[model samples]
Target: MIDAEEKIVQMADLEIDPAQIAAYIALLAEEIEASVDKEPGVLMLHAVSVKGSPAKIRILEVYAGRAAYEAHLKTPHFLKYKLATANMVKSLDLVALDPIAMCSK
Candidate 1:
């Protein structure tokens, strides 16, 4: 297990059409929740959207560290998600953050 002192944050901004954004988010969340347990060092996954921006999606993913985050990106589930959602996403912005604290012990 990773030390609680180490944490990582991943933020994603996705641009999608308003009509399909809700369905896309629901599907993505289900996929994330289903796949997270298999991902090593993943602490939690939180997905959100702006109140006024139905087309925008924001994700906050917490991992054990940089290595964990990298591994997560390479997972089959993530790859599948990327491929499946390619058409739904118009643009994406991903940011990696340094961790100050973690929920995992």
Candidate 2:
């Protein structure tokens, strides 16, 4: 059974520098993989680019709870990703979500 009320969901909207999109994605992949593989609280970290706008990125993040999401921010891989992609990111927006219902396989 899952405690839906305890889950923390967020969406990240990002714009990467056109020339640095490849490099930004590489770092993001490393961070997402490490986060999901090593962190028990990380439920999901899915990223995608707009169909026609390769530089526009969106990430859907789901954590077990607030603490889990906070812990994720302190992870080494995340820190490294932030540092490495700082210059590659042109803009970033993070939005919190309150899921009315949740379902997954």
Candidate 3:
């Protein structure tokens, strides 16, 4: 069971180059899969795009805590994704959150 108050949740808002959206999505998928499969601290990683703007992406990330999030940043898969997508990304905004309630079945 996860303690909602102890979790570190955040939203990653990114603007990917229109021409590179496909490539960016591929990398993002791979990274999310690897993180959840390999790290117990990684609670969730869900990525979605706006209704009509495919280049505008948002990722909802949930980690066990600050240390878990920090550890994720140093993982090989995350590092690879960051380096590979550096040129494809136009802008990125990271928003931290304090959850009042969180649940999943």
TM-score of each: 0.78, 0.95, 0.95
Ranking by TM-score: 3, 2, 1
What is the lDDT for 56 in model 1? 81
- Which model, 2 or 3, shows the larger lDDT? 3
Candidate achieving the largest TM-score: 3
User: Across residues 1-105, which tens digit of lDDT does each residue of candidate 2 receive?
Assistant: 458889999999999999998888989999999999999999999999999999999999999999999999999999999999999999999999988866688
* Candidate 3 local lDDT, 1-105, one digit each (tens): 767888999999999999999999999999999999999999999999999999999999999998999999999999999999999999999999887767688
- C-alpha lDDT score of every prediction, in listed order: 0.78, 0.93, 0.95
lDDT value, residue 82 of candidate 3: 96
lDDT of 1 at 35: 60
lDDT of 1 by residue, 49-73 (tens): 8888878888888888878878888
Q: Candidate 1: which stretches are off by over 4 Å? A: 1-6, 99-105
Best by lDDT: 3
Off by over 4 Å in 3: none
TM-score, cand. 1: 0.78
Poorest lDDT segment (10 consecutive residues) of candidate 2: 96-105
